[model samples]
Target chain A: MTKKKIEKQLSLPFRNAFQMSLRSLKIRFGRSIIVTMSILLGIAFLMSVFSSNAFTNALIEKGPEALRATMQQNSQELRTRSIWLVSLSLLVCVVGIVNAMLMSVTERSREIGTMKCLGALDRFVMELFLLESLAHGLLGSIAGAIIGIFAITIVFLLQHGRLAISVFPAGALLKYSLVSIILGTTLAVIGALYPAYVSARMEPAEAMRREV
Target chain B: MPKEAIVRTIGLKKTYMLGKIPLPVLKGIDLEILKGEYISIMGPSGSGKTTLFNMIGGLDKPTEGKVYIDEVDVAQLDAYELAWLRCRKIGYIFQTFNLIPVMTALENIMLPMIFAGLSTDEAMEKARQLLVTVGLGERIHHKPFELSGGQQQRVAIARALANDPAIILADEPTGNLDLRTGKEIIQLLKQMNREKKVSVITATHDLKMLDVSDRVVWVRDGLIERVEDRANLDIKIGEVEGEEAG
Candidate 1:
């Protein structure tokens, strides 16, 4: 028999990984929703803070001189507190994402082993996980932004009547929403990195040996 | 006619670390499997049949020595090459029938072909044909959870043949089935071995496997205890029992 070199087969396209990730997210919808909710709450808090700060600045600029002095002091303190709260909330969000991803990896160890046995490369495994997290981040952030904008709009309508719409600071609010969405997506991918790497580097035999 | 050896293992050894201590699983095993042959490696739980199976399938690297599949050294291949070898040359069937839970039976079979670079349409067509071949033609759209144990195993068998692999490695293929179902699985495997001309190597505790295997390798204490041709084994126990009943 002639000795044949094992030629490299074509790597699977990115579309395959994307489709698989979508299917997985659908199949594990409950878990995906939980993960998304964590991101949603955190981003909602962030967007609310941003828009409120923008509205207050608009108010301070247009108020009487005496009212402006007092309002500036109050706004400074509020900004400091909100920053701390937002940072804390975002930190909790990252932790939540990391925990969820780790649990997902553990639960699917056998499935991972089966995929490896079926010729999935490490890159493919990583791609599946990263893509899944990206989807969660994108959806959660969009929903959170909308809720945050709506809540702030309602609060302004009650507080200042017609004046709230006149000084809504729409431009600043849009910019902040964009920032929050990008941050949420980036944090999600970062949180999933360790779990994806661990799954990608798993030993096929050892993974299969695990009962679950 | 001289038989061509498709899988060859030379002094393969594997050890697992139990915390601080070393526990040897496969001390040293040398074996050869011919092309288009059906062989069973039989042993108890701790006898290391699975370890040897892993070695031959390239699922794990041996602690020492070499495993050659189709005259190519498995240990020498890089990660990419190993993936290619696994995708194009070897098919694996697990006792648990580890089909992806999210995928339908048809999709599960198509996955391997997709990994091997087939277009979705081509993979689906071939997967559909394989499902029919395994007698699960009507269950192609069903998820694994919706299928019975035997039905799921049939899907797995079809998945194993997805890429037209040269070899099939089954680890306790029938360990989860009842006697009748197990016999059906064995018959399916034998038929695949004959029809596809793919080498079939199984690690099993199923004595029924001995009836169809070209050779039976009994493993004990992480070593090949003996190798026996199927013809030489005393398989007349069933007949003797019938005689006693008469």
Candidate 2:
């Protein structure tokens, strides 16, 4: 093949993958929305835990002179508990994503077979499923971050008459939101990989034989 | 070696493992398809016509023997090569109109061209032309659910023609349609075969296909029981008598 031909072949999979992902979202609109909401709630729980005034204040309440001593005494205990809570919430979120993706793959066996019959590469199939999960992850995480910020603001306003922005550090919340987005995306990809792999490696004949 | 035989199979066999028992689906078959010939494979359910079709299409690997398409041994080609062959060399139409329901008819038709490395504009141009050829130009924007069973099959035929493949393998292309619609689809397929000179291999129980086929293959119990040329169709009567006698 000429260079132009090679380039076209290389790029074709990405284009098809993109189209396949869009089609998947359209076909499974309801299920996708539910998965996104689940991720949003999980990330929301994470944000609430970190942004809640009670938690932040508990760490910052001690005076500077005693801060070093308090940090030495209680920092390890607080960090461990926070880690556990965050881990548990993210775990729940990942489970939901995996369940949704597994169902999606199972339901689309015929579609997958049809794609394979049309000469879709395994990489194309992988890219399709991965992109779908990534889209859901990003959307859900952004929504969760915004919801978390508003939620923290509401709690602070109720606790104090003013906005009380100082109660939650802007810098810290921004960092946490960014982290949540990355974590959510990573979790979504991980959860979707196995099912996508299975779908991609399926024999076209066997996949076609399966009832949708 | 016949210069015109585009597809050839030798001792092709496929066995499925039902638990520990080796249940053979295709038992040692030899067949050849000449270029641009319309061949209909007629068989009862579970007779392995689909298995043989799958082998020829490179959709499944045979347990034993070789399937050669245009002189390339299918078993010798790696997965990537096989996929490319499927994309550029063969087209498939299914009984269920196995279209991606989320896609519009045009998108479905564009899929194989896209796989064959055609740019979006090129694929779209050819897809539109194929839709027109299949008489589905008005339904290009419709999803599968929006189209009737006959219309969906038309879209599928358009899709099967997307890449302008050398061979079209249709597995019961009219199995789901009403008789009138089925006849129309068969006529459309015949028109394409004659005009485009693309070989068509249809595995079906529909006798209407015999009218358009250049030859007919009868399969029974995982074996090709007989092959009859259109000009010599009296052979079917002889085979029936032979079976009755045996």
Candidate 3:
């Protein structure tokens, strides 16, 4: 085959991604579902925290100085707790992603080795993992966005139908979406780095060997 | 550092030190594999045939030596270059037929092309042609688990052929199949070698597996015990490499 044919053959994209994801999914079937769920839970927690803050903001507005002082103190207490929970949840998810990626790459060491032996470049291999990470993160983010909004809406009713029509969540939605995207990309890259590195480094012979 | 050898090794040594005491996997080995040559490496368990393969294949670095594949000293390459060489040149087949389970047989075969950076359309077209060539034209959409062991091995062989590599290294392509299936797989591999003219290297404990190999190399205790041409294979019975029956 010509150089062009081989190059054309090796540069397949969506199929590669789909294959990798499927393999990754089976290799860590239980963990992937858990990861998706964990992401959902984290986003839900954020939504609850935001709506609670808004609720407290409304309650504090209705009172006199003495009640206002108490509400202010309570509000401060709520902020501290919410911030702590959010931070903890984020930490847990990060660790989870790291673990998921680690397990994924480790299990597929032979496969990665095979690819390299067949003449896959490091950047392309890196991109494979990076792409998988992106897909997972994006899928999670999309799911999280839809779930988060619903969560926000449901909790908003705790204020006794004060919000009659759906308010345009301009700044808040945009900010959260940006934040999630950033988090997703960061997590995806961080997750795939070590594994991709090991894969890119493997020699073809060792990669093809039978364990027994 | 020999000029004519596509793969050359110089005093290759790999040692695993456990708490200061050293356990050597490959003691000191030197050899060469020229282009388009079919070779089989045979040894019992723990004989280090696998380790030797690892070092030569560039899947792992040698502790104290140089390995040159396709004129580039693999031992001298940084990570990026090594990866590039692998993607563009080597095709590996594992004993387990490690096709990605979620993907169809066609997708599994398409993996190497994807790694080489082919656009999806072009990659798919090539993948289709390769799959059909391997006689799995109708099984393109079937996942790995959905296929039989022999079929999976065929898909793997097709995948190895996907990159049109300089060498095809199979650890034990038919290890998991029945004897009949094993023979069929060997025929497939031989057909690949003849048609594609790609070099082939296999590592197997199955004496039955060496019939089609152009050369059979026996490795014991991390050393090349012997290398025999096809005509001389009948005169030699390989020594046990590692595991012994009680």
Candidate 4:
């Protein structure tokens, strides 16, 4: 075949990979939802903590002269404790996403074999898993950010009544949500890498035999 | 010169490592298949017929020797090149009807074409045509779980034809079906081999294969015991099956 023809043929495999990812998510919708929930909760946790920290920092920056020093001391302590706790929760969530993706890869060995036999390249196989996880990450992160905003708002309302609204800066919450989205996507990609590699390197014959 | 054989294997050999023991699968298989010929590799279990199919289809590498498809040495091709060749030149069907369960019959049929780089519209058109050819047009929207064994196999056949491959390799294509369904599947394969001029190489122990194959290659213990043309098939296939059963 001509070079142009080869390029033309290369065009559809990515589209097919994307479609395969969608089909997989739909077929395993329950598992997908669970994975999404893990990511959402993890990101939401981080966002809420960060938003609260931002609120404390803002208080120290603009609080009454008499209260600023004590508030600064309190903010330092809260930041240190929350950072360690948030980091631990995030680690657990990453591990959970990795475990979920690994299971998904194992369950689809035969489907992977069939795709490989049909001429899917290793990269295409990798792309399918990565895209699936990425979709979950984007969806979960967005949802988590929305929920985190409400969570931060609720915590502040309960703690400080109507004055809590003034202390919870809109700009700070947006920043926290943005940071959580990025972290969620990064964690998801990291978790998916090993599973994608496992799926891509599977021998088609062996994979099919496993299913049979 | 005459046209080169569509598939040729020279001294093809494969061995597996089972702990410290070595198990030979294909012991120096040398074979050639011509275009449009319907050939069957007949053997009992452990005869390495499936291994031979995998070699020719580029699904596995041989420990020794070479596989040449359309006169191109398969070993010399990189992974990308092998993938490209598999996509555009060969199709495979399995006994278990390895259709993606999550996909509808139409989507399964369109898969190979998608890998071959056809646009969605073009792939869908070809897939629709192939489904009709395999008599699964009415069931195109059904998932594999919803289809009968025969219908699922038909979907697999349609998927195999999606790329319009020069050769189709079927590994125990009817092994999972009933007698009547097996016979029907064989007939469909034969029809495609004849009308489309697509070479077909099937590994099967089914006695009915003796009726449809242009040539039969009997493999024993990872070696080709004999190759016989249909016109010169002196042994009674049914008697052979009965003897094996006994």
lDDT winner between candidates 1 and 3:
1
Give the CA lDDT, 0 to 100, for residue A199 in model 3.
55
Per-residue lDDT tens digits of candidate 3, residues B135-164? 888989888888999999989888888768
Report DockQ per prediction, comma-separated.
0.60, 0.40, 0.40, 0.43
- The C-alpha stretches of model 2 lying farther than 4 A from their native spots are A1-20, A23-27, A53-59, A62-84, A160-164, B1-3, B234-246
lDDT of 2 by residue, A1-212 (tens): 11112112422567667777877787778988887887788778777766763434533553244654765587678778878877887677667656765666667777777888898888777787789889988888889878877897787667543435444467777877898788777777777767667766877888878764
Grade the docking of candidate 4: acceptable
Q: Which segments of candidate 1 are over 4 A away from where they belong?
A: A1-3, A63-67, A210-212, B234-246
Q: CA lDDT of A81 in candidate 2?
A: 84
For model 3, the superposed segments whose C-alpha errors exceed 4 Å read A1-32, A62-70, A86-106, A145-149, A163-185, A192-212, B1-4, B117-125, B235-246
Question: Which ranking of candidates, highest lDDT first?
Answer: 1, 4, 2, 3
Candidate 3 CA-lDDT value: 0.70
Model number with the top TM-score: 1
Residue-by-residue lDDT tens digits, candidate 4, A1-212: 11222332443456667878898889879988988888888888777777777776766776566557887767768778988977876776667656665666677777778788888888877787789889988888889888877887788788667666666677887887888888788777767767556655766786676642
Question: How many clashing residue pairs, candidate 3?
Answer: 26
Ranking by TM-score: 1, 4, 2, 3
Which fraction of the native contacts appears in each prediction?
A: 0.70, 0.55, 0.61, 0.57
